[model samples]
Every structure is written in C-alpha cells, then in structure tokens.
Target chain A: DQQVKQNSPSLSVQEGRISILNCDYTNSMFDYFLWYKKYPAEGPTFLISISSIKDKNEDGRFTVFLNKSAKHLSLHIVPSQPGDSAVYFCAASEANAGNMLTFGGGTRLMVKP
Target chain B: AAGVIQSPRHLIKEKRETATLKCYPIPRHDTVYWYQQGPGQDPQFLISFYEKMQSDKGSIPDRFSAQQFSDYHSELNMSSLELGDSALYFCASSFGLQKGSSEKLFFGSGTQLSVL
Candidate 1:
C-alpha cells in the first residue's frame, strides 16, 4: 500500500501566479514531511520541510503547510516561475523510523511563461 | 557542494544474471541510503547504512543486498535479475545520524537497470 499519495499527476500554472501542490499520507507515525523537486534525468533536490510540531514552514518563495489532524500537507510557491516547473515529490518519515522515507507519486508542475 | 555520486549510470542484465550498483556519498557524509523507482512509480526505500552498518531496510527483494564500506560509500547488489527488476535505482546520503534526523536526503542522478 502507498502510505504517501500525491493524487495529482500534473499541474499547470502561469508565471508570477501561485502554485499549490497537495499530498496526503495514511501513516500516522510519520512526523517529518519533506518536498523534493526533480528534473528529467536528474536526482531530486530538497526544497522545504516541516516537522509535525508546527503547522507551517516557509523559505523564500516556497512554503510548506502541514495539517496533522487531516494527515495532509501542501507546498505553495508564490510568484511561480518557469524554473519552478518540475516533478515535486512529497515524502514522510518517522523520527524514530531510521530515516526510511515513504514517497508519494510525484506531481509534475508546469509553469507557463 | 559535492552531491551523492552513483557509478555505471546504466546497466543491463539477463534474467538470472547479477548486477552491482555503486554509490559515493558526499565528503564527510556518514549515512547512505538506497531506493528503487519503478516506471511510473514512486521511489521506495530499500536499505540504509549509518557509519558502515545497516540501519534500516524496506521493500528490498531477497535477491538484492547492499552494504556500506568504511569510506562511507555503498553498493547494491542484485542477483537473479528478472524483467521486473528493471527500474531506476537511486542512492542518497546525509551527513550523520543525529536526533533521528533522517530527512533531507541528497539523491544521486540514479542508475537505470534494465533486465531482459
């Protein structure tokens, strides 16, 4: 069973607009959530993360929101640019779970210029 | 900054054959992880090592095994390859084990393995 799920396979947004990607998880043990962006033929790069302790974390134009009660999380990019277009994966790990990450099926975002 | 490096970016094997994929973690990194991504699928954790010792494992087939060496590099060995074994294998790394922080995995470009 897929513990993490990114229901949206792809998303499209216009440049300078806000882009939001959503993810859900079934495992309640997961306490740490992360977002990674990947390009074709390249490895994923870490974008942002949020611990279960908080409801939100932001860095630059990237912001991650976590709702533990709903077992859902979302990544928001303000003023989205073409460079932000890529496959975004959401992952979760339990602090005591030895760092084994459970990944969601990625969401491919296209920011049209 | 140096990222995780994986060798033999691509490999092909026949059924029942064997293949070995390698990973070189960043300088000073002490943890290494292995993941497998099937076509149209998400990455699944296989195994991980911290300080050259097995720390965690998940969804790895019995035909597969992995180890971390003293230099902090890692290798995933797959035997008895089957057509289903074809996938993109990714290697990731972190600096060290601290406060149970296993997130923030820096991944390699991955090695695509094709089994015929």
Candidate 2:
C-alpha cells in the first residue's frame, strides 16, 4: 500500500515562475515530512523538511507547507530555474519509527528557459 | 565535503547469481540505510544499520542480507537474484536520529543493477 501519494506525474513551468508540487499521506502516525530532489542517475538529494509541529518551513527559494487536518503537504520553488529541473519526491516517517521513510511516487518538474 | 560513496556504479548479473553492493558513509556518520527504486516506482526502504548493528528492517527479501563493518561502511548481499531484482540501489547515511531534529540523510549516486 502506498501511504504517500503525489497525484501529478509531471509539471512544466517557465523559468522565473513559481512551481508548486503537492503530496498527500494517509498515515497519521507520520510526524516528519521531507522533500527530496533527484537528478538522472543520481540519488535523491535533501531539499527541505517540516515537522508535524510546524505548518510551514522555508529554506532559501524553497518552501514547504503542511496541513495536518487534510493530511497533505506541498513544496513551492520560487523563481524556478532551469537547474531546478528534476524529480521531486515527498517522504514521511513516524517520530520513533527508526527513521525509515515512506516515499511517494516522484513528480518530474521541467523548467523552460 | 565528503559524501556517501557507492562502488561499481553499475552491475549486471544473471538469474540465480550473487551480487554484493558496498557503501561508504561520510566521515563521523554512524547510521546507514539502503533503498531500492525500480522502473517507474517509488523508492522502497530495504534496511538500516546504526553503530554497526541492524537498526531497522523493511521490505527486504530473504534472498538478501546486509551488515555494517567496523569501519562504519555497509554492504548488501543478494543471492539467487531474479529478473525482478533489477533496480537502482541507493545507500544513504546520517549522523544518527535525534528527536526534534530534521533527521535528513545524505544519499550516494546509487548503483544501478540489471539482472538478465
């Protein structure tokens, strides 16, 4: 069973525009959520993360918003650059669940210059 | 500036053959985790190790085994491989889990294994 889901398979946006990627989870036990960016032939790289206690977290040009009641979260990249094109994956884990992450099918983001 | 290192970047094996994948964690990191990503599928957690001992288990098959060495490196051994075993295997490392922290992991480039 896929506890985490990303409904959109791919997205395209113009450079310098805002790119929004969404994710949802069914497991209420998960208290930690993370977003990773992966390039071809490479591993997923840590981008940003948010804890259950907080509703939002921001790092540089990336922002993550979480809605506990809706069991959903999203990642937003401002002024999207061509280098930002990659697969974005959403992952979650319970606080004491040994830090094993349950990942959602990634969303491919393409930024056109 | 060191990151997790995975060897052999690519490997090919036939059915029923054995394969060993290695991982070298970043300096001072004590935790290691393994994940597998198949074609058009999300990454699946395989197993994890902390301080050279098995810490957590996931959907790892019985045909596979893993262990962390004294040097803090880890290895995954797969025997009796099947066509379904073909996938991109990733190794990640962390400094250990701390409560109320980000608990982010540093991942390697990954080893792509193809079983024919």
Top of the candidates by lDDT? 2
lDDT of 2 by residue, A1-113 (tens): 89999999999999999999999999999999999999997889989999999999999999999999999999999989999999999999986886789999999999999
Write one digit per residue (lDDT tens) for candidate 1, span A47-105: 89888999999999999999999999999999899999999999998768867889999
CAPRI class of candidate 1: medium
Error of 2 at A28 (Å): 0.6
Stretches > 4 Å off in candidate 1? none
| lDDT per residue (tens digit) for residues B76-108 in model 1 | 999999999999999999987664365557899
Off by over 4 Å in 2: B100-103
Find the 10 residues in a row with the least total lDDT in model 1 chain A.
A93-102
Error of 1 at A58 (Å): 0.8
